[model samples]
Target: MTEYARGLSHEPPLKPERPQFSSGPTVKFPGWSLDKLKTESLGRSHRSAVGKARLKYAIDLTKELLGIPDDYLVGIMPASDTGALEAAMWTMLDPARPATVAAWESFGNVWIQDAVKQLKLPNLQTLSADYGEIPDLSTIPQRNDVVFTWNGTTSGAMIPDTDWLEPGREGITINDATSAIFAMEMDWAKLDATTFSWQKVMGSEAQHGMLILSPKAVERIESYDPPWPLPKLFRMKKGDKLNRGIFEGATINTPSLLATEDYIAALEWAKSIGGRKALFERANTNADLVKNWIEAKPWLRNMVSDPAKRTNTGVCMVFQGDWYESLSDEDKAAVPKKIVKLLEERNVGYDFNGYRDAPPSLRIWCGGTVEAEDIERLLPWIEWAYETVKNG
Candidate 1:
């Protein structure tokens, strides 16, 4: 057993037989097995014919699942979602033009960091909200480029609706939809560029980023004169034309064929479950299962106080108490530590602790691969854990 698996303790009578509720890289794809890649030419050079074909398969499968537009370009970019976002920022955003970057959590903050600290872009506006709320898009200055994350994973918050996006306004809108891919509807017409990672909901391994560009994004890549130098990997549209070859499996660096096969499997699994509709239903069903239980019990409250913006994928919650509120960061960490340890000890759920930077709250991944039955199974254990730990 791997360290993660070994860490799990065996418990009888109430052994978890269904799916697990993990936030990320924790999906339970159907018939998932690492050994399936044994027939794959994963050992061959990425530049080899088989490797290229694998890369192409990954891209095509993603496009088909997502219903990407014909005119848009899809590429298997380097780095995870982080790298893909950075590449877009470095290559596409023009420092001279006014820019606005809105942040809600870590991922969005990273983009803001790159814009201000790293690239030192000028005429920039940083709009941010603390966890649950979102900045008013109407208040965002016009004639400025925009950057935002589709879902705030840490806060379990998301833009409640997409009607706020105004397409006619000038400047580009770059989105990091890493956890928002199939779980939410993406109006590609409103976004100039978007990025996502495979591990969050696709149940695939990490180390790959998928970048999709609108024609406007392509125009920006082709025409914009960035104030700084563009790295080789960040450069998307090469010399005023969309690099069509990249879409055809010409990755910037070597990609793992095994990972590609895993992604393909995830797509296949996604399709078998009835595409995006089923995907969203699964997420909603799982989240609703947890939310309904939380509502019935007075001991818990959702981290995102607002029900409208509460995310279905990363569902977070906090115990209601002055004791929890009165604790320092160290003491807060201790409570969650105790809670998670008990859960792990019972093999109920592993790694379901709150984010280190965020306030003490349980983070649950309720994506498509995580079943509603599992969420139902998890709630009793959470109650058991609270009782088991608090009594100590």
Candidate 2:
């Protein structure tokens, strides 16, 4: 019997549309209930006392949820994780010291482009691996700064631990942990700087970036003299001094209070649900559901070659068999397309299609908002979709 037939079944009076498990802008929690968003209040002046209090409350709640260190500064910056990362990079890098970057995906490559190709930093170096693997950390240059993505969302690959980092390095480590924050464990003691957005596991609206800097990052910002002028948004340190106001609710510009409140609400929800343990359990449960399904079906397997390196949040898998390889280019492409279409037609999932840059692989979201039972129910629908498409 299918798991969906038992307690895993959806509640009666189903919506014409089913739940969503796409990469971003995902479905609300299965039992999440909230009042209408307070968008009207967002247009008012953010400099007002009430606005300031709300912003501060949001920041405080976020810090509590993430268990951030007391010395660290968690500030709201412009854009998403991209802006936060760029701000750190542009403001904190010291041209005098060598810089090393680990390029694993699209976002990592962008920073390397800036440090090496665009900025023309003479000491720039990159240790890159293919889509599914991480380059050897020992290969990174010593006595120089380093950059890496904790979770490569595009490739469904992740570095499971940070133990490889050398202690007492002369330079800093800037990490773009956009998808890894909250979804995975991050050791602040081992990292100098990190950036993330609320859109992923937090399930908040996009556009705002949360940049966290350690005391070491602060010291670098205050002492190092970069070869470029720092933009107001990216200004963490200036003239041998750290900008204290940026950490105290003085964002580069006014942000939507509605979004800020939503972020706070989400963080609060995270706390209420047992914090990191709850979040990690959800990912583990979801991944196990999909993995069990894959093991039962010989025709499909995860695209990530190593099971240990597989991402718990963004799960990617591909079809197997000579039947798949025997087909023409268009025919092979059509297999995943047909599977996606059938699933959509049944309203079981959306945006399960593989990334355009990658081979034919199904990308599913198993983030914080997703419940274990929902994932269990969704697996059968995948099998049904594949069969429906193959038979048709």
Candidate 3:
């Protein structure tokens, strides 16, 4: 037997009933069944009346579940959350206005790159923080268009509240909230545009994006023509006016009907569990179980130091044992891989490793779909994996 395997005197007594902890393409809602997707309009065109109605239902359900404002327009876009955010940036960010981009993690950094290198905006401000920290939201210019991620999926740091945003400001706030939606409560009144995907909290199939736009955002798109040419897919405007049809169920391209039905089923499950508040509660409860365990276990510490900034969905953690702390950077990186491999071999967890661009750590998805009881079962396995890896 291998040295690491031989070190274990006993196996963990229990395993998580569902072992999917991926930040994206997460576990499906509890009790989800393939039969729920049988009613999908698989052979019909997305522009057909039946297809359009199904798309509209998805948008309406999204707005209702998230408590989006009545004036906000929600649409299904191409690609995933990245496509939704790019569409917002390409369409709504007027060259006349200065741009401010804040980033503390990998996905947030992607937005910063789009503003600087791609758009090549001359008037730009970049606010950045380390992986486990959040940039000062108050420092973002109120008079400029702002782009940021609501939650740092890699870093596990999230904006605590929207109180920092200025009310009645001229700036448009565009947020990539792929990992935050459904799990956290957002102040939609403070945001002009928000983007998410079906794969994150809902555990639906990927390759689809949802863009939520406020009246101000739509007005910006309708009035300002961007200096750079917008690709056909990114174009939100038809002539001088906004493309109202896109917001009303006419997608830019064909969509996966199967994925659509899966999303609908997930939304229905959310409604059955008492909507957004209950979803938030479920995620929070899962996070609490981890937080409490971390408090009791000195070997582990939260990646994000500030408890308030810690996200309930993607829970990143770092090893803090003296031996672990003494290791070289290369060794430290290998350790997490070893631990994660051990867990996977036993089928206690999967995709719990931190993002490639972030610090070496563990990232556990504690979103609404994940049960607290499953997390409770997984914690002991994590402890066991760490011990075996560290000892070997």
Q: What local distance difference test score does each model get?
A: 0.78, 0.76, 0.89
Q: CA shift at 322, candidate 2, in angstroms?
A: 1.2
Better of 1 and 3 by lDDT: 3
Q: How close is candidate 1 to the true structure, as a TM-score?
A: 0.92
Q: Where does candidate 2 stray beyond 4 Å?
A: 1-18, 33-41
Q: Which predicted model would earn the best TM-score?
A: 3
- Looking at model 2, residue 168 earns an lDDT score of 76
Worst lDDT window (10 residues) for model 3? 1-10
The residue-by-residue lDDT of candidate 3 on 11-109, one tens digit each, is 677899999989989999999989877574779898888899999999999999999989999999999999999999988886677989999999999
Once fitted onto the true fold, the runs of candidate 3 whose alpha carbons sit more than 4 angstroms away are 1-6
By TM-score, is 1 or 3 better? 3
By TM-score, how accurate is candidate 2? 0.90
lDDT of 2 by residue, 326-389 (tens): 7788887788778777667667678878777767778888887787766766777776666555
| Candidates 1 and 2, the one with greater TM-score | 1
Ranking by lDDT: 3, 1, 2
